[model samples]
Target: MAFVKTSGYRGLHVFAPITPTREFLDVRHAVIGAARELARRMPTRVTTNWWKEERGERIFIDYNQANRDRTMAGAYSPRPLSHAPVSCPLEWSELAQTDPHAFTILTVPNRLRDQGDPWATMHEQPGSIDVLYSWWESDLADGLGELPFPPDFPKMPGEPPRVLPSRARRPD
Candidate 1:
């Protein structure tokens, strides 16, 4: 898995390179499928819940970022935070020991000279996302399906109702 510190933000933006053979919906489905599997495998640590109230203490996947028109930063992109933190790339081995706040506009130059670029060959061998789509289909058969979209997007087919569970009108 590839992850970058989001300008010293509390969370990391995680993703992988795909072959770019699918459209938006298909890619989203794959992401959801993969996230579900991850949540299942590491139930206490990860989640795919769209609603913050339901996520409990897990690290949410934020799969909605898979939606079209999403915005994300690449390695070395600066964020408009007070300390001028940059979206720093990471090696898988060092992720546990690394501190997001340590990299910034002033420090990254020295870091690059010391460690080289972790994302240098990221796109060299694009992998198929097809297996994740297959996981999506399997999930569908098991009654798991599309998730809720953001407020600005159009409702999608097979999507669960937009209402939050706590606020859904109950039968009288």
Candidate 2:
């Protein structure tokens, strides 16, 4: 179904509609490159799926002085969906065979936020989307972001240890 018809999220799907300026795009590319490097360093494989939008109610992300809008591209910083650069939605899903707690980063178009029936165009070809970004959260928060790994966490070649030798082996 079209993402627009969806309502508020339950569980851990936190929708974040990001409006990227030319500058933001540069940052995103850098981040993506870094993630790729990190994957190579770690044992777990990491991939990204970038999404784009082409529909109603364009997302105008304001990122300026935090107060008065000194938006990028001037008034066009958050231009209409039609005018914005092609956005790439990068979704990262981490799957570790040894790790029981796995989470997914869902990147989708702003269309998902529409309260009305935005899926009407699914039958026909849809236009460009308005918003896109990744949402990362834990499906199992019981002890998420705060649990200890096994004593012998495998370390990939060339990868640095999570802690220095001194820290890994508590100073006695």
Candidate 3:
């Protein structure tokens, strides 16, 4: 697991890679649980601009990034958005002092030349998601179930009805 602060915001972003599995929703649940747990341990905040409005502080796990079809920008790849910013990786300790704007396409190469890749040994050891899955089970025992999926995905097994909460009809 890795923690990063989003550029231009005081929000936390977590990146967790799990072994290949067909149980996508289960993975999503576990990841969310883990994010919540991490949030509880840290002094940071999480926010989501889901509906064009900032939903105030909460642990917002980006489970959609875990979807099979989705992909994130590579560590050194330049974003197509403004200023040609690059998605640079950083050491966990550097989080407090690092500025996102300083690591752009033109500056990353020199940075890399001066200091080798922070993620150089990232794949030397593998991690298991078993503990997270266990957390998933514990959350289930406490009555928590699946969270919402992207609107474009087909209705999945055990998924809650896809209606927006405001339009959802409550049980009679």
**Which candidate has the highest TM-score of all?**
1
Per-residue lDDT tens digits for candidate 1, residues 38-140, read: 9999999999888888889999987788989987776788778898888888877778988888888999989899989888877887788888899999999
> What does the lDDT come to for candidate 3?
0.64
lDDT of 2: 0.26
- lDDT by residue (28-83, candidate 3, tens digit) is 76675665556557636753223223345555657666666776666777767667
Residue 168 CA displacement from its true place in model 3, Å: 4.0
TM-score for all models, in order of appearance: 0.92, 0.18, 0.77
Q: Which candidate tops lDDT?
A: 1
* TM-score for predicted model 3 compared with the true structure: 0.77
Model 1 accuracy (lDDT, Cα)? 0.83
Candidate 1 weakest ten by summed lDDT: 1-10
Greater lDDT among 1 and 2 belongs to 1
Give the alpha carbon lDDT tens digit for every residue of 1-172 in model 2.
2221111111111122333343543333333333333444652433221111221232212111121222222210122333232222112232112121111122123423333223333345432212211211221232212111123545433333455333467557
The per-prediction CA RMSD against the true structure, in angstroms, equals: 1.6, 19.2, 3.7
Cα lDDT computed for each candidate against the true fold = 0.83, 0.26, 0.64
Candidate order (lDDT)? 1, 3, 2
